[model samples]
Target: MTSAPVDQQDSLAAWLSIRTTVPWPRWSGERAAAGPPAADGVRDYFTATRGDRDPEGTARVLTALDRALADAQEGRQLNFALLTGWQRYVLHRDPVGFRTLPAFAKGGRERYGLAADTAARFEQCLSQSTQPDLPLPSRAARTYLDVLFFHPFEDGNARAAMLALAFVLACDGACLDQAHPLQVTRWADDADGAADLAVLIGILISATQRRQRHRSPA
Candidate 1:
């Protein structure tokens, strides 16, 4: 994987202040409002299914994420093992794990992630997302963007990114109503993409909070 640009890193750090005040909703209320917190909803967010081409992979991914989210809701911070398990499920055929060579995507034609030799750097990125100083939206968005830019897994990086985002939010007792928007129109090299991603997470935070408030009566 290619190294992240310094300017983009700086921009991401600066964005923590941009949406720090929006309160993260508690999972307890979400469970109450939605009738129960279900991992199936997360699968629904991606329209995940055990189709012929990748049968069982979708179910495995969903099961892994459900366990991850449940752990997060209980106040467990994300770890490499959690993410690796998710990837193993998503790319069940390749459980030996992560790309062993440089990777690239169409948007940024070259050096899209840290070179395959730098597993420690990727672990550091996941570690940083656990820092408490940043707000939920910032942490969640940064983790999502990190997964996008880091491109850690050999396949199903997008699913990993969304799961990273959801795990961060769940750690803070929040969740998004929809996550499909995160799967497209992202540019690893664009500062605006980073900023917009934070904004979108903030929007989802606010929308989810609004729904939860309605679900609870004063």
Candidate 2:
């Protein structure tokens, strides 16, 4: 008799379990220096990654980014409705909704199983983007991973993740000048990788501020 295929473990659960335990790096409240507005790194990222093959799709993403940034600037809370609004543009669809079935990624190695409370849990996670205790980098990093592991939408989830990351930083008046470095495969269960991402975000924020300072006139 042949053996059956092994069931994939719930990557989402693994992520939620370790989310609060990750050793997020500390930040000293450093922010980007005052100067001429920097080029939109999130726009550049989408353009470079998808513009060649899908110009229309890239345009949609940029439009979504615009809306996300606007909401961030207005101090809007991050939630499913806000995300769905932007996601409609990213996906070029009128009626986008959450994924009802389990989602898989990384060549089917990781699965995000949906429970009745999954969406509620996701919203709770998003709300933490404004958590008072955690520093900006940690909050931003956590929000990014929340989107990644939640795998909320049926499609365009990666784009959604990037938008969420950008929005989280923008909420605090922080903008990264280089988002390319953040494009990497993130495993749901890797606690060290999660913390490393926070460190990387902190570095990018400081680097952007440094460049802005250099460009500013004395």
Candidate 3:
């Protein structure tokens, strides 16, 4: 007789336990230029990845990204409600809610367990996006990873993560011109990988700002 499939550890818990301990990189890079907004990496990601196969879906994601950016500009706090508003547009459905059951990803190699307070915990994490002490890149990276490991939505979590990352950066007056570099697989237990993501964001932010400076007239 074959043994039963082992229950995967809760990746969400793994993330929460180490979220604050990760050695997030410090960012001293110049902010994105105020004039002529930076190229939106989220839009590029969606268009290039899904434009051909699902044009309509791509359109929906772009719409959601615009709305999310608007909300960020208006200084709206990132929270479950804010994300759900975007998710409605993403899924083309009304009344999106947190998943009530365990969510799995990566071919079921990772599982996000749900508890009575999972939603509350997620909201607590989102609020930290505006934490005054942390650097923008660190906040952005943590928020992105939070969405990823939490697996809050039944579907479209990856889209949600990208949207959150964009919103975080936009709130801090930054945006990445290229996002393809961020498409790699992320494991919940890898603290070093999480820190590296912040470092990469800093590099991208600096590169985008540098390019903008070069293009600007003296």
Candidate 2: lDDT of 213?
A: 84
lDDT order of candidates, top first:
3, 2, 1
lDDT of 3: 0.90
Candidate 3 structure quality by residue, lDDT tens digits, 1-218:
11224676888999989887999988787667755435766789899998999999999999999999999999999999999999999999998999888888988888888899999999999999999999999999999999999999999999999999999999988988889999999999999999999999888888878777777888
Model 3 — which ten-residue stretch has the worst lDDT?
Answer: 1-10
Reference-based lDDT, residue 140, model 1: 78
lDDT of 2 by residue, 121-215 (tens): 99999989999999999898999999989999988888998999999999888898889999999998899999999999999888888888888
Residue 32, model 1, lDDT: 23
List residue ranges in candidate 1 displaced over 4 A.
Answer: 1-41, 48-55, 107-110, 113-117
Q: Candidate 3 clash total? A: 0
| Model 1's TM-score against the true structure | 0.73
Per-residue CA lDDT of model 1 for 34-81, tens digit only, reads 333332335676554344456567677777688778778777657667
